[model samples]
Target chain A: MKNSIAALYLIVVAFNFSCGQDTANQVATISDTPFTPELLVEDVAIPWGIAFLPDGSMLITEKSGELILFKDGQKNTLSNVPEVYSRGQGGLLDVAVHPDYENNGWIYLSYASEEGEEKGGHTAFTRAKISDNSLTNSQLLYKGSPNTTKGQHFGSRIEFDDKGYVYLSIGERGARDDNPQDITRDGGKIYRFYDDGRIPEDNPFVGTEGAKTAIYSYGHRNPQGLIKNPKTGDIWDNEHGPKGGDEINIIKPGANYGWPVITYGVNYSGTPITDKTAMDGMEQPIHYWLPSIAPSGMAFITTDNYGADWNGSLLVGSLKFQYLELLKLNGTKVTDRIELIKGLGRVRDVVQGPDGLIYVGVEGKGVYKLVPKK
Target chain B: MKIFLTSYILAVIGLSLYFFQDPALEASMQRGNEIYADFCVTCHLEAGEGVVSTFPPLAKSDYLLQNRAASIRGVKFGQQAEIVVNGVTYNSAMPSPGLEDDEIADVMNYILNSWGNTSDKIVTVEEVEAIQK
Candidate 1:
């Protein structure tokens, strides 16, 4: 019996040694530098889009139509934000400072507002001046297609290109079938407008009637992530798909992207959407996630803070994965992927700050900075 | 020999206690409940019985109780088709919700327990990822 017990012990020990798994991949201690995601602003409800102001401060837009200014690790809540149509995917979305903001003092904001009767709400961009900590001279710059019941599918993301043109992403607003058929509809499209919110005469769809002249591209679902490549002057975006096909596409002027027609994702019940992942005249995504990462805010890595490996890479904040994804881009292709922060709550947006530090905003955990550790 | 054997048994028991029992379940469940209230309660309903004919009912769902893989996959990727539950068909669109696997497992556990459903198996994050395919 003693020899039998010894044999059993040896077997168990061997099994334990073989079965031991590493836990370092699961949880990580929050770092202070080289990237510490500490809470810089607290008690903000569902903060979504963030724009860095000229003076190194930031303007963050909450889903509930509150625009907050963060400076020196303190928050100053600005009031009189226009009453937003605060429903699903509605409310104040992206806030951006104009390229000539230093001289113009013009700040542009995107929000969903109630349209005429029978129409639910549409996304509208407004330009205003921030003086005395208040929004003044607020004027409507652009308004999206109106009349929809479902409160979801407002792809309101804003960015300014190197040419000083503001690019706005509009979702299909849950209207999947309509995306492929109509260019006149503002949903499922990217619109490019001048600083005054007027359509550029040289816009790709400028001569098309019924179609909004400001439209730059079409055939998108709800693109939530939009960023301009600082080096190559390229625009990129990622949007949610029906069941599992969330996509990241390189933005091109006047390109028709395939929506409900062509998708790698199937329906939620494992039903196939469309076998054709690419169609003629429809642009293809540079990269896509099969199981839907629910990617939200994305920023291009322009600096060398994360070493040379991460330079020219893209940091994508994954909401479903609850991680910050690093995408190494070679030309237009995303070459590699590294998940930096895991077990952290939903990361909302990532931004490169003036201090050469990377800042990331979490849904409930506040904002954090990624810097090299000492 | 007797003293050494006794010490070895005690060490094994101590390590088992430290490793086997989940220390995070209580806190995770609490946080899961809070998250459910804010994000899930609207569609899944306050009682976890999702809207009939629109959102499939999560209460005592065979999909929830039997097919753990499908349940996790359904949440990971939004369900946007006609899914039958308990002989009833539901056709609706649910957007891919933004939730981590740990939280997803915690909520699945809560659903499996509270809503007239019972299962001995605990949903783990590993199980959630394994069903991603």
Candidate 2:
């Protein structure tokens, strides 16, 4: 009748494309390479932060907007690297270079753009410069506000502190009772700048009011990890909780840290997030990770090349424990805990190079280099 | 010899235009791979390797080929905590998805084109009904 019902719908779409099955997100190694580790690049898509290039080369990114560049081992691609607005947590996110990057070639980055007509995208922070290798000028610095399209949260990440100042991590995006009363909303804060973008009068909301005052800390919710604890210059973050909680804290400044109002996580339909966990004005989590290790990107390892028994430890990567967890504090209390690279699949971000080794990044096995196995 | 017969007739017209191509989104990537194998294969698994720290690896996932509407509103509502994909930072918890709007555009075009991903970009249910909600 209609040509045999369009040929019986092309034979049930070629029989569901001959049973298309493929599911292999990798990261559970332990055949123990004693530290051979060197795949370099595979089908990389969800890569996340790398940043080296004082000549040692490396720039990575990829939460889907691309931006590669590995050097010597080769892998280019870095023309514009913008178009982000990728939604649900946003895109392009985190890059950081300019710590006077060999005489200011600049770089910065922290995406999720495209706001307007009912907002829909947020979390910004630009800067740009590069030249022969791509990007140029760009600018922007910081944006984020009420911008809601319901793409989850944004909380971009970019760190630096050794007096050079510059830390950014803003997310509360899914609202979660708006972190603790908006405070002009930069989406549950942690900001501070001056790498040319300015705004560092000791930010704690500098002048306050409708507060855009490049905040410094506020009841955070999404924080994705930030380093700088060369002993105690302090600044250690490790967020993402809800359903078992998942914090790590240490950040300070104008503090708050609570979310959905003091939680240890409950409410993925389990509902509760707050009934205990010792509220007050909030702020408590020097260590947490009950049924959720979802952490993401953190370092601290402090050299000694994994020897002085992992000198002053810290490690932390665990995209749900695909492995890396080390901890071991003593001063800020974490007190020993090791897991080292167990499965390997979702450990998306942990850096410490310049040859002191230790560089993991996997969201589908692609970048690894944790040397020292004598 | 005349550039080897014009490079063997342009490699037989590029292998007969890639063997009579017309993937036209292969039946919406086999209905987004059976709605990502019955609802995102139990914690981005069945090969998305999302269960290390605790679920989050969509093969070539730069947060789903670069945040298309927050990864289509995390497949229409489901995504929590501070995520950071590609530069490392993921807070976990992404459940939302009962499926509709053409099965979230046939499972996000079968995850923007399976594992290795190339991205010609084809996610429509009128772009998920213009970002529902």
What tens digits encode model 1's per-residue C-alpha lDDT throughout A316-359?
Answer: 78776668888776787766666777756667788777666777
Classify candidate 2 by CAPRI docking class.
Answer: incorrect
The candidate maximizing DockQ is 1
lDDT of 2: 0.73
TM-score of chain A of 1: 0.88
Q: What is the iRMSD in Å for candidate 2?
A: 11.0
Residue A81 error for model 2, in Å? Answer: 39
| Cα displacement (Å) at residue A252, model 2 | 4.5
DockQ of each candidate relative to the true complex = 0.03, 0.01
Off by over 4 Å in 1: A1-34, B1-133
Each prediction's Cα RMSD?
16.0, 23.6
Residue-wise C-alpha lDDT for candidate 2, range B41-123, written one tens digit per residue? 53566556564445567787687677789888867866555776666676654535445678888888887777787577678
